[model samples]
Target: MSVLLPPYAEALGVVAERDDNGRLVLAMDFAAHVRGRPGFLHGGAIAGLLELAAIATVQDRLGSDDRPRFKPITVTTDFMRGGRDKRTYAAAVISRLGSRLANVESFAWQESEDTPIAAARLNFLLARATGSPNR
Candidate 1:
């Protein structure tokens, strides 16, 4: 199954792929459209990547379009360093999934995963899909 990212993610050229561990990883190539300052990726773009990664993680977990819906309740992003003009990667993990809420943490990095360019925490409100078997 694949996660259906929004149009904004398409505009950002976000690509989803499986890492060596068979985990979801989101990637974006740096372009003029995604540049902010002289040579750095736009802050908005980084935040967008984080957000999309989170949504993708949740959607991939649910595994189907007919699964429950998750709506972002709050998002907090931290910028650690400027993203250079290169391919950037992001990965997210669900910290907690509950009947009514979910917490996800995403990190964006370039060159090294240990050194993150940015990170984000997202809270989502979960709504059960009508007549769905999976919770």
Candidate 2:
């Protein structure tokens, strides 16, 4: 299935691909627009990537038939390290998915998966698709 990302994500040069484990991996290329300080990535850009990854993960889980509507409740982000000038990758996992809510966690890393530059925990309120029996 094709994954649809927002306009902002496209502006940031973010692209989606499947990892070895067959999970969605979102990548953002470092550029002047995403730069901060001398050569580090902007925190906001990193957070945005995490947020998008989280939403995509939830959407993947819900599938096309369900077509669930998502309302973001909150996102807690932790900056683990300074993101250097390079391509950064993020992947999210659904911690919990229920009829009314979803909990997701995403992490961004550059050189190594063991070393993450940032991480975020996201909570979303899910509304069942209109005309769906569950709705």
* RMSD (Å) per prediction: 3.1, 2.5
Tens-place lDDT digits, model 1, residues 67-121:
5676788999999999999999999989997767789999999999999999999
lDDT score of residue 57 within candidate 1: 89
What TM-score would each prediction reach against the true structure? 0.90, 0.92
Candidate 1: where are CA atoms >4 Å away?
Answer: 129-135
Worst 10 residues of 2 by lDDT: 126-135
RMSD of 1: 3.1
Candidate 2 per-residue lDDT over residues 1-135, each given as its tens digit: 678888989988899989988899999999999988879999999999999899887887777766677778889999999999899999998999988889999999999999999999999888765543432
* Candidate 2 Cα outliers beyond 4 Å, as residue runs: 129-135
